[model samples]
Target: MVAPMSVWPWGNLGAFKYLLFGPFLAQVLYSRMGEDTAKSSWCLHLLIIWGLRLFIHLLLGSFGNMLFLNQTRRIIKQGVDFKQIDREWDWDNFLILQAFVAFMAYYIFPSLADLPLWNTRGLITVLVLHIGASEPLYYWVHRCFHGKYLFTNYHSLHHESAVPQPVTAGHATFLEHLILTAIAGIPILGSNWLGHGSLSLVCGYLVVFDVLRCLGHCNVEFIPYRIFERLPFLRYLIYTPTYHSLHHTDLDTNFCLFMPLFDAVGNTLNSKSWQLQKELNSGCGNYRRDIPDFVFLAHVVDLSSSMHAPFVFRSLASLPYATRLFLLPFLPIPFVVMLAMWAWAKTFVISFYNLRGRLHQTWAVPRFGFQYFLPFAAAGINKQIEEAILDADKLGVKVISLAALNKNEALNGGGTMFVNKHPDLKVCVVHGNTLTAAVILDDVPKDVTEVFLTGATSKLGRAIALYLCRRRVRVLMLTLSTERFEKIKKEAPADCQNYLVQVTKYQAARTCKTWIVGKWITPREQSWAPPGTHFHQFVVPPILSFRRDCTYGDLAAMRLPHDVQGLGSCEYTMDRGVVHACHAGGVVHLLEGWTHHEVGAIDVDRIDLVWNAALKHGFKSVSAPRTTSSSKSNFIS
Candidate 1:
């Protein structure tokens, strides 16, 4: 029963495939020992196989200097600009030992003595079975390697190469290498147990498998896009070069080898594949390099009492309506008068390091007291914002976020005026209000049906109110003016989704389960609420808080966990465990791909993105939840 020429279908494609496979002697074993007995020692035979693999791999690395075999060699030379080509040799030092272990652990006997009766049907069946079985099995195994323990000790060594080369494909701990080799044998073992074994086909399959593995990791793409662009469906059948490269960069995505079927099934496909592939092909890593690595924006506030003017503004803002009106002439200069006093605060360049010890810096610009209370500040603030953009441009900021009054002034336009004004400049200005709203909403309890909100006329308050109404949640809009209160009530119905929204003005001596400190509420105004209720605080200059406080405060998304305290060391302090929401928005823009992405106004869709990113990075309230404890941190009654 002589196996026909088609029995070793891949064997005859000799010259180049044999050079690439390197185990030429194995090919000879198949040819000469068709029906012969094994006389030579099996140990020497196995050693020769491993030695040939290493030799062939080194041959490819060396020949990369001499000639081009596919586009892979040329790509390795230009793609990542890897300075140390010799580094692979360092990783290669372990190969012979790994190969010996692999042989001893699995391929011990003279399996070559019984080359199966190979047929075309068995070849196709086994190839398909190997691919199908390996996809899920390897997907699971690969995910397991990402576990914190295994990744730190074993699998992480391979991930050191952000830009992988061919040699890196085999670079792994002995355990990982063993696991890979063992899984490759599963299909063959199953076929043998089913009485349909074919060792000859297994040999060809291994050769193809190795070639594809190296090709994927080679850092060069030879697969013509025309094949997929024209046929489209063909992409699902085979993994592309970019597919594996994405897996190396993003840990949770692109988990499958050989085919992406399991990756798609598990919903782990890299969402940025197209954008990243284009960049990779252009010799850029997965992220943008066009802009400065870090950028931060700030809105300046006028100071009267300490840098935190909340104390000063509270006294003037909280006087009884008649008393405040009689004293209107003495009220802190109107925004117009203050606008004349505006000057760009000294721009501070902060140099710092992250938890990972990566050095980063930010440029902060202060706007002089432009919050809404200043009245005519909006129009004046726009011009100052222009000046801030110009200053930020001099330092080459890639992304900038508007804070506080600046965000409020630009809420509707969302810095579009600034963006449109500086069309020629290379700076991206964002309102960042979307993320502000997101973190605030994250602190609210999911089951709550009624929410008491202040600052009913302001953008932050309105955004929160509308958001609640759309979800059929009732909100009590605490307004000071009867005129403004009625206006809001009139517009509430049309603004809500299918649900009819309920909104009401706050009166004296009221109590509620949940209160949202939505506006730039003074410390005195905050006391008006029942001290027994739960509070979601969004004010930048938070009211002072102490242990065993009367009311509990919910703070969300603190960048510097060390900043949390019962009494803030800076100008103002938050209730213990409370964080500022706007801080997370700034960080999200910096770490996310530098797309010059500006989150303007309230895009519910973009808000979800920042919210997910904040949670993924563990940026949440780090203090104890509320209870009816009493303390003297900064009680104001």
Candidate 2:
């Protein structure tokens, strides 16, 4: 619980808090545009300081979240939650607000503003003042904040996050940050008052401060213990992540800022800090992390959406992904990384979470959605996916599900090639389309006697057509190939065969009020559907809602079990706690511990079986709001 005094003045401004620098930015732009380019340098300096503060957090935060990193030695075993993320959403507001103060300081003290770019004396002065005055000041002030009255009113908010991450370093109350600002400013301002200040000195001090702060809270012990082994006294000179984690767990010890020497002097240092650091550093190499029981083999949707990975941005990954204006500047970084992945051509872990004590992970095939469409990229993509499956088999993974384009029919025959070639494999390969088909079919009204279906020759389309035909519903399957249509019709019972009718044009559905679209359609094609027609879709990149009068169903999806934990990232465009039907299918497979592989053609007989299994395991269908009619079809416009 946050005390009333701990609340910030901005009161959870979120991303909009960056606008606090707008007035300073406008002045910088105006000065740069006019004759006084010299005055713009200080403004630019302040902006760079602000930017570096944010960049350091992102760099360390993303690095710590990478599963390939030394995760075995992670301080906290649990994942971050929405509450902690929301609390730290405005973590950088302090830097922006302080920069505004610095901007005013430039005008008040012309000597401080017109300093040289570099000065050896200024650097020396800052290092001396930081060690001699600033460090001691911060250590004592920090200990004072832990006192009962101060802790309850101001310090408890920072301590709310027991499982710390990079941003947790800045997650403090306004009054606490005001004191921190003074601690950080003393060395630089003291240097300026002594006539040795320089722009490089301020920049260097701020960068080093952020680096140390992020390192202590990053949760992952990145620094090697070999250095301290070589020089034992250096342990007091520098503190590791393990050192700081003990402080959060045991609030009475290890309260120094960046150095353990101060804590030692104050008699508040934890005795086990060095011993635990050695244990963690050795464990990183001596032991392996826990293997996941389930893996979701996924692919990148697009260039822009690639940055929505958990490692990249925690806040952005928590919500349904969209193209944001603020994210445009960061595109070049992912572009370079994308080219490297394309060249490497391997499957890598993206993120993971736990459900009912079983570990579930998501791994990517290092290819984008467009690359899957390219004729030349199919073989390489399949090879990577096949290797991942084989690796999981060796590692004793119970179930591995192919998601999105990984299960594309033309690419690898819905993962049939791998399963067939490795017939003796232990791992259960799942296409997860059975549950996907069930979710779509469940939306069809029981009273409806006829429906128009597009892309009827596709995998999912064929199953829906056959299932409905068994119930005596007339299925107008639109396809150019009569031969393919007959193949699916022949699979149905002899009595139900006549219920499947072949139609090649949208004009044939002019009077149809129920349309199931498995393929993309334009406004002109959609015009064929009669008014009040509910368009049930299984299409990728779902069709546009050109007609407001017509209702459209969302792609098949299901809500995850309530027992799910550490689910910090959204699955593509799904909302929090919801997953695509294919993803839910994988979860159901794991929970049921089914032994057989779920690959190749979806079994129409097992559609109800899988749907019932999903419900039995507490997964619910993701349905939109509906207006009831006499027909009883549930859909929204």
Candidate 3:
């Protein structure tokens, strides 16, 4: 018969201390505890502290629903929808089960707790070894559970709540929870059995560590990164709020527990995704990745040939109506220019290349225009031409070559025209017909950066653009005709301008590239505002700089300065005492101190000015008032 271990007479007192007094003592000790003293007393002290912390959290957790409900109500009233605040009792049950399993596995399993390995000296060594061993062990086991077979059956439940709530931490199948707990606990038990430490020390370490784990999973935002991340060694040793938040947001990243170092080393950390989520949560405008190719392709196929198609159906649906009106007219311009240039490049540029047979020569044109396309269309195209020309002074070869046939046909047209326009533009335009341009590209001055073709279709231009992208040449495709420009803009990829370079017939490609690189063109130049009015007045502080009494043209010319951080949306408001300009999202009041003056509820002239200002600030379309939905009202109320 197994001998039953009797509870200590002071066990209840110890429990009380563990659940209450210990944490308070730990807080006090945190300030005064010397490094050696802290390390020496870690097991005894942490056992008491963690016991108390865990008990307090569990005690408070009984009312966790009420707390969440209150928070939900507050958030709803603050404009966030109630539906967005996920309230699921299922998650609570899951978290409880996970905790229960972890406790049972750590405390109950005799093979682990009674291991002969951990009967050694010192609490700090035991704690560190336990933690170091637990992480890698847990990682591998967790990864195995994510395997196709196990994932479908057990792991899927945990993943159901991608935007994990506080209650989501422990939500898993009982079996899955048991498996995970065992995976975490078995290593510590094995470490102890290996003669590394004592069971008492292990228990104390487990208690404190588990309490911190629960606190980390809790949605309490009291301990922010700004405070905790500033700490010297603590930043690296312990998990911070931001670390777990990223795990919840992006399931694939930040898999390591306790510290991010392992995840960083393993290349599983996603800092960018985490940063993006933080920005979104802070009410910085909705940030989404540029539309995926398949989605963009769907839009193009569905809305092709319709003028309203580009305006009515696009990722720009989020823009204000005024902004839409201002920007929509220009949407078709890039497409049309792209198409015409494609035609010109195929007909003339490739033909010139084929006729010359001197495909090795480099061409130079102004740095701007469909340079992004050169990589894919032409094999052996020099990649360095695009990189070296970061500024006018650093500009390299002025001429580039075009392949006869390649994948993206769109480039064959516009790209050709863009290259041909440069005075020193060289062409290696190839022709299958045996009839080609007599110009040997090498014979042309090395100053040629642009190339033109009269035969390529939009398809060919796309090929050239893709080719240039591979070679890293920033080729610009230009069109002389407005109609054609619109077609090309509509047909071209969203990143085409950045890569392929699109220009109107009127603008000099070389001059345009120079201006763009130099940032010389003012917002008024780029914007569709009326001439003469200064857009500079609208250019306000860090968020937006707007010119006062600026015409649409003036607003257009006002490019966002390079130094501005976190640029989102620019807004113009003509409300109250003076024409007020503000950025959208954050609350900015006019008065120095509190005076009951709402900027939105100003004079009618101010309202008109605000509308004009929004237009000047580049709002695409304003949202029309909708009949208040019951759901929306409930959420807001």
Best by TM-score: 2
lDDT of 3 by residue, 268-329 (tens): 77665335434434434443211110000000111122222111221111111122244456
Order of the predicted models by lDDT, top scorer first: 2, 1, 3
The candidates, ranked best first by TM-score, are 2, 1, 3
RMSD of 1: 23.9
Q: Weakest 10 consecutive residues, lDDT, candidate 3? A: 292-301
Question: TM-scores for all candidates?
Answer: 0.40, 0.92, 0.30
Give the residue spans of candidate 2 off by over 4 A: 1-5, 12-16, 30-40, 70-73, 284-287, 328-333, 625-637
Worst 10 residues of 1 by lDDT: 314-323
**Cα lDDT of model 2 overall?**
0.84
The local distance difference test score of each candidate is: 0.53, 0.84, 0.34
- Residue pairs with colliding backbones in model 1 are 300-367, 301-369, 302-369, 555-579
lDDT of 2 by residue, 1-637 (tens): 8565577776656445657778768768998889766667788778888888788888888887776565677877677765677667667666766887688778878677688888899888998999898899999999999999999888988999857888888888888888898889889999999989888888899889998998899888777889998999999899999999999999999998888999999899999898788878777543347689999998898888998887888778777766667679979988898899999857888778789999898888898888899999888888899999999999899999999789989898888999899999999999899999999888888899999999898889999999999999999999999899989999999999999999999999999988989989999999989999999988776678788889988778899988888777778767777888998898899899899999889899999999999999999988662222121011100
* CA lDDT, candidate 2, residue 91: 71
Choose 1 or 3, whichever is better by TM-score: 1
Number of backbone collisions per candidate: 4, 0, 163
The top-ranked prediction according to lDDT is 2
Which RMSD values do the candidates have, in order?
23.9, 4.8, 25.3
Deviation in Å, model 1, residue 6 alpha carbon? 82
Residue-by-residue lDDT tens digits, candidate 1, 1-637: 4212212222234223333334435644664656432422233444555555555454433232221223222332222212222223234433444444434534554453354557466665676667778768898999998999778777777887555555677666656766777777666555654556564555555556666676667555556656666786666667766777777778899888777777778898887654445554454662322234444445434443222221122211111111223334544543453444455334443212232222233333434543544556566556666776786677576566665555554332666677666677776666666667776776777888877887655556667776777667777777766675555555555646433233443434256667777665554655656656667766654444442345656444454434221111121232322224564466566656446646344555466787777666656643445333322211010
